[model samples]
Target: MAIEAQAPPPSATGPAVWLRKHFFATWYDTVFSLVFAVLIYLALKAFIGWAFVDAIWRVENKDLCTHDAGACWAVIESRGRLILFGLYPYEEQWRSTLACLAVIITIALSCLPSFWSIRRLPILWIAGFATFVLLMRGGFAGLELVTSEQWGGLSLTIFIFSAVFVIGMPLAVLFALARRSSLPVIAKSFGFFIDIVRSLPLLALLFAAAVVVPLLVPDWLQGNKLMRVVIAFAIFFAAYQAEIIRAGLQSISQGQEEAVAALGMPYWSLVIDILLPQAFRNTLPSTINQAVITFKETSIVTIIGFFEVMASGNAAIGSGEWGNQYVEVYVFLALIYFVFVFGLSRYGAWLETRMRLGHA
Candidate 1:
């Protein structure tokens, strides 16, 4: 008996057909879908009501915040500068703003495929980082000299994340390569070092970098707390990222390496043109996930006396006057984090789609 192939099922082109086909496909599905829809509706309604309808926005209305049932956005109006700029000299905050903008623009440009080359990326980041440091530290071109100790808020957070990624990514590739070295001594040593670094918590590493390193290292080698912390963070980032790269490398078949080696290709060309590109491509999802996590982890620097956005938000609401408005301050901070994280997530999604479609 020959079976005839039936025509493909009709598309859910109409609203009624789509709803019935998806939401009410089964009794259980219908129940779950309706429940979730109602829950979402209620949540949105409550949030909108509290966030906008009854919220206080006037700085002078701070006194009425506690008495009201809704959000007190007045705290933001009053301490917005502190939240965004931290302890940066109020007069020189424009420099911090510009520095932050530079880093952001640099990051945005780097994400574009046009600047993906090794040479272009290094030059772009160097220019961006230099602009950031010069603007923030500014003893040059008649700009006021501001020490890093006073750097805080969003600018500090951006600088730390950008520096760590730029430094750690190359180190991650090196560590991964060393771990896979043909020499037992080199491979074992690199593996052991990575294990040791990964075994410890990031907080302890950062604490030691900020506090303990100063007491032990000579003054010349000590550098500033900020630099120490950044270095520690970069090292920590590399140790974890290396394993991800190694996994990417492992995904490559032996034949690919053998075929390239058969042609007596240079080692550098093998890696640059063959191994690393495929490794990174294979590991793109994980790499992007790691980057997103690293960005969020910048908040942890607050524990070691640095004031990133989270700490700055705390400072915004810590004063006795606006103390009751912690909720609003935290919400604002969450929104800031959401914007960056969401952007990273969307970019990662776009990259995945592009690569999957062979357009990348």
Candidate 2:
């Protein structure tokens, strides 16, 4: 009898072989693949030539920029300061820079595994937020006072993002737990509250907080417009995040809870020690998704009289001299947004990896 032949392992296949197997196995597949490849190459080449080969980078040579080709990067160099620190007094701009750096450092530090403990995390956050508030709204230590109204640009944007996440995350966990309560009344009421908030548009919620609430509330009850808006944004974030968390809880096997109960663990221990940790791990991607959405939505505060990064970018180009450079200003602003969002995504990935290693 002839010996049986063995197939080669899949890892032996190279990129060319993989592509041929997936996209050129049939005649129609081969034609579609070729057409898509040509279109992608043409588009990529055009973008590279326009953005790099013909782009202007110096403020001195700005006048030479023409309509026919190239990105106008010179506009960014000329108006970068204004975009970064909108309406802030030129002399006090350094304070804004330091304050923004402090917040960034705070965010980065909090993402580290060492600071995840309840006690350490709160202390770290409080100290960080205190420093930010003191530097931005300075009245102590003889530093010049800057009102929230005067806060704009990247600093304001950072403040809002930080405030929303810090406040919203805890609230979301509470809402999720409450909605899953064993008591019918408590669960139903909590669910209704979350649904009501989720049904409203974020803009409308923001507008109500910034404008309508002040009119109805007593003088002593009302806080600063910025604080009110932050609270409203936090509420909105909590509602959506609660649903994600509850879904994670539902994905968990009932046997896990039953096993914990059989081991004589209290309800709090069972939930906190077993359920929440697993739920959060399972829902980490959705949590990160919500955070990214929250960060971008901070730009919407510009519509409610707050001057965040987007509004600042508009002010950078609204000037008579650089009005034609709006595209460059927006591009610069986009890079700033990308940096923060990208960092957040990377941190989330790191957390997921750590969790898989049982180090979370």
Candidate 3:
């Protein structure tokens, strides 16, 4: 019996084990895996051939691309500037470029952990956005003035998204707190307002802001149509975001608030130091989702004649020379959206990981 004792047979491991378990454990599994692998290989091969191997990359000889079985990247090479900067005066595009770079830098700075503090973030954004407006508008400091109407393309899209978020986030926090207030009248009033705004269509709200509000307000108070539209968009965003904040607020334990209150912390301190941080952390995913939605929805402003990036992309292909290259233009546009959206997704994932390693 002692002599018969032996070690167990060696087990499959590594990629071989993983493949056996996941892809080839059974006959049907093996068949399915082979079919899917073949499909993926074919798709990748087609994409690579069309996008790189056979594609036209140079700006010249674009007409030769018409008969080719590949993408016409030449259109993007030719019209990239127009698509990015829209109808801004070509001579003054340098200002628009600087303005966009400022906004981008501001965004990048905000994502850094050091800028996450409340005071630092507010100051950073104000300084960055102020610089953006000054450079873009430019009636002062000897720079050529460009009206908001002249603002278009990617810069306009980023401005609208940033402005909406900057204004709406504070409004959303206030709305959430007001809706949760002890005073019945205040809570009910805020709740009703939020519901009403959320019920209306966003496009209709933009239209009213751009059109009807002007007729109703005094001429002196009508303000710029772009400003009015932005305000309306912010208010709309706040309505939905408030509910997300409220859900986060409600998730907090009653004992947490009670403990903070028992410690003699001021109401403001309790909310700011204890409750709001937890609430925001709890709702980070929803908040990021809302932001991404808002970013995409900015394109809807084009319906009212604002030439954001999406509209600018369309304009790139609207010309006779690039008319047949719509696919290439749209692919370029998709990449633009992908860069921002994918960055947001990755940031959200990072935040989730960071928070999981923190206090519950």
- Candidate 1: pairs in clash: none
Q: Write the per-residue lDDT of candidate 3 for residues 1-360, one digit (tens) a residue.
A: 368878998786899888799999999999999999999999999999999888989887676787565998999889998888888878888888898999889988998888989799999999989998898899987988889998988999999999999899999999999999999999999999999999999999999999899889999998898999999999999999999999999999999999987999999998898989899999999999999999999999988889899999999999988899998899999999999988988998898888878865
* 2 or 3, greater by TM-score: 3
> Cα deviation of 325 in candidate 3 (Å)?
1.1
Candidate 3 global lDDT? 0.92
Give candidate 3's TM-score.
0.94
Off by over 4 Å in 1: 2-12
Question: Against the hidden reference, what TM-scores do the models get?
Answer: 0.96, 0.90, 0.94
Number of clashing residue pairs, candidate 1: 0
Candidate achieving the largest TM-score: 1
The deviation in Å at residue 161 for candidate 3 is: 0.9
lDDT tens digits, residue span 1-360, model 2: 998998877765789988889999999999999999999999999878877888988989888777875888888887787778877777888989998888888898998888888799889889888888888888888889998898989999998999899999889989999999999999999999999999999999999999999899999999999999999999999999999999999999999999998999998888788888899999999999999999999999998988788998998888787787777777788899999999899989998998999953
Model 3 worst lDDT run, 10 consecutive residues:
60-69
Inter-residue clash pairs, candidate 3: none
> Candidate 2 vs candidate 3: which has greater lDDT?
3
Clash count per candidate = 0, 0, 0
The order by descending lDDT is 1, 3, 2
